[model samples]
Target: MTQIPDVAVHHETVVPQAQQDITDGGPDMVQFVDGEGTRLERTPANTPYADIVEALTPEDGRSMYRDLVLVRRLDAEGHALQRQGELGLWPSLLGQEAAQVGAGRAMRSQDFAFPGYREHGVAWCRGIEPEQLLALFRGVDNGGWSPSELNYHLYTIVIGNQMLHATGYAMGMQRDGVVGTGDEERDAAVMAFTGDGGTAQGDFNESLVFAGVANAPLVIFVQNNQWAISEPNYKQFRVPPYQRAQGFGFPGIRVDGNDVLAVYAVTKAALDNARSGQGPTLIEAFTYRLGAHTTSDDPTKYRSAAEVDIWREKDPIKRMRGFLSQKGYADDAFYASVDREADELAVRVRTACQNMPEPSQERMFDEIYVDPHPVVEREKAQFLEYQAGFETEGAR
Candidate 1:
């Protein structure tokens, strides 16, 4: 055996850039709409995406708004179920509705998506039932829906791991000659979703390196919702995720996560570029997590109330509703109908969550492997024997 050399490690204090403030995306951030619902005047930065936004019809606007509302409702219901002790835990997508909805709407059916656990809104866009998601939280199933059926992968709980999975899948698509085929129906791209914290993971960095080298048709969507649980963006890195993408040899864009139009246009453009053999793109969705990281967390402990208040002003649902009203794309009745639908969805979600059947204790051993192993069989027997001891004790 060869002797391993011992290397001393040095630690340095992280000094984030003062100029590159994570709080605001600044002028470079692509936004088509303002917080007040006004369509912004086209600037040079937004010029490329202007046509994409302009081509949207009133019906499309209504449909996007509908998705935003319904997804929000689904999220609200999930949060409530957790509060009511119906779920093991719930990750709320309270404020990032537009970021997810916009990206979800931008994808072609052939395109595949790998999402972080919090992407309930994206699941909505992918035709995943709210009950299916609830099943995961309620611990009824490993994954309630089929990834192949929806072209959406199962929710990846391990931080940043999905980036590798998505990159490998994109490279596979490249090998299969499904990318840059000139056929709209044939060309497909893979999208990997993660939070700002994910950028710090080695898997994310490795995936970017591989994607850049292979020119994989991949889009790494970083929903920079300000905080990585307790740690803020300032603690994550000196350069933001988009700017960091340049080091990996791909173009990256930061978009207003609250602006549905901007997110849709940017994501559509990025996906198009990937499909056309332009390689990977990193999208930093500048948004905020208006709620706790998960049901088990308390945002009030680590975050300030004032910060939450400020983000509430940039609420994606409110912003979209404002734009729809301003464009005359939806009447009051239409808004009311959407609200009714959301309420009905909430009821359905609540009912489904409550009705989910609890799995038998033996169910845990059923799918540990494709083929049964002696060790697993022994463990199952031990577990059953241990469980029977309680019954024997009760009889005594």
Candidate 2:
């Protein structure tokens, strides 16, 4: 048997950089605010930041704010439901709201989104109802909405699978003559959302290779939230995630994932580049996950509370709310209204989950094949017969 190198058997060390250069490295990945909630002006590297923020009207700001709040609330509710045994499993997007909402908002109506399972915020921005998200968790359906309807693909549970799908979709868009007509309004692009963990998968690397070769109109948004299950980010790569893009023949950007403004600006620029036939861009949103990997995992066993506390200070919602208040964009009434909306949404989600009807056994076999397959038909019939026999025997 060939022996695999044991990482645990080797000692690891951190590379130290000079503080001044590292500190002044041009806007800390285009951040509008630091982790301490300090606002900074745009530098030459972050020049597009101002334009993207300027593009947002008061209405757009309100919509983004609403998305951030409602999505988080919905996520929290889902976590609770999972703990209560109403949901089979739940993945909390706890500290990564800004990354999802900003990039999601940057997408055009016609642009498609291929998302990992934690993209509830993206789904919300794409017009998916909160109730529909719960269906996946409640064992009611695989997915609730048609991907064609919203241009948002179904949540892909197999990590990095959606990267290939997004790349293929972008290739199709290119073949359909949708790339580089210089019409930003009508041109289509693709945004593939994946996590830090997914970046290690072979499919992700292959997708980037194919995307680079084809010059596909796709934006690979990687949310590097520090921890992939129990493993730390340091274990995944020697350099940062964004730096990997250079090897893939695309411009790579690192962004403060907790900063909504930065995420919006960078993603918008990437999308614009794709629409203009500039090929793929990789954006690594540097953020932290303040929750467990899923409802089933106990993060406490692997991580320290001190690390969580540090990230909580950099909470995206809090930072955004601070900005809103300071800019006089939102008042106490606005906060109250948002809270009420969240409450209403929670009620609706709970009701939907409680009332969702089980799909008929016959319907399960309906969409398996486009053309008739006798073997599958026979098996489905036999399974239904078995189920019917159990019911006839009074087996609940």
Candidate 3:
């Protein structure tokens, strides 16, 4: 018999276990920095993952913090732009900055990255222009960056599809003899970004199966932000989500997704392991989504304002900033400069988005094939003639 809980009990049941990490900050989580921005002791007695951050120079620390601030400011500004009607819709990456940044920074130039739609931070780490990140939402057909040139593929709006693409790419890398080479610069790896929601799709499961069977040099980076929109992880999986990776013949590690330092260390190690011919690994970044599911969602309908308040204390940007300040790695001047630069970036993005030219109507037919296609050309001509009959340019 099923014992159904009342509404109050049901809400408590689904709430995530974020607070449990408060006592010994890194237990059950791989963290270099705690929620209060204090750097925990790096010893085997504490977090075994401490070796990754142990050698980071002060300069490296400062740059990581700077990037965190810039990404957060960009995300906030994008949300405001959406509310002001500058974009069609936005899938906010509000609380997942650390997860994306750490994974992206770990990649070498020779490696390839496949991104989900909400990977603005990853795109930034890959040197993608801020305006390019907005184009897809700004009614522009293209995001203005070449995938092959940047080694960062186009964002996949279709959930879990990029993982499949990444698995195939990793297989190709293996066939090309790019993995397990002693030469560091010549070896290759593939990184795929997906969300907790994306893991449920069959494409993701299939990708893991292919990766495991082939022993491909791939890292499956899953940002498990606790909720797939309003449906929490409890509703989606019966056990811890990261554990599923072991079932597919790979090692899965859970990390403190809000801790940028931890994420960088873990991702880099995983990528190196893959390049060394180790099988695929799944990194489940344990984090939360602080904003609505999207511009179209109203989280208030299903979530408590209190839950959001708790996650705010663990904001990635704030945690990294505090750590840098305490260590004297960054001062007020450095922070002020970052703020000014972020403002300049926001202005540039807004201006570019406003000025993006509408794509030509014939562009739809232009990329169908390298060679001419008679059927498409005929249809295109007929469509243009029909448009000419309508007197307005907007109709065309």
Residue 283, candidate 1: alpha-carbon lDDT: 89
Across 1-396, the per-residue lDDT of candidate 2 in tens digits comes to: 111111111122443322122222133366786665456777655665567767677677667778889989999999988888888999999999999999998999989999999999899889998878888888787577889999999999998999999999999999998888877677989999999989999999999999999999999999988888997766676666676777878877878889888888888888888987889888889888889999988999977787788678888988888877777778999989999999998888888787889877676677677798998899888999999898889965
* lDDT tens per residue, model 1, 1-396: 111111122233455534443357766788999888999999866877888999999999999999999998888888888898999899999999999999999999999999999999889999998899999989999687999999999999999999999999999999999999889999999999999999999999999999999999998999999899999877887677887887888887889999999999999989998998888889889999999999999999987787788789998888888998998888999999999999999888898889888898877887778898999999999999999999999999
The collision pairs in model 1 are: none
Tell me the TM-score of each prediction against the true structure: 0.93, 0.91, 0.90
lDDT tens digits, residue span 274-293, model 3 = 88888688888988889988
Ranking by lDDT: 1, 2, 3
At residue 309, give the lDDT of candidate 3.
85
Model 2's TM-score against the true structure:
0.91
Candidate 1 local accuracy as lDDT?
0.89
Predicted structure with the largest TM-score when compared to the true one: 1
Clashing pairs in 3: none
Error of 3 at 144 (Å): 3.3
- What ordering of candidates by TM-score runs from best to worst? 1, 2, 3
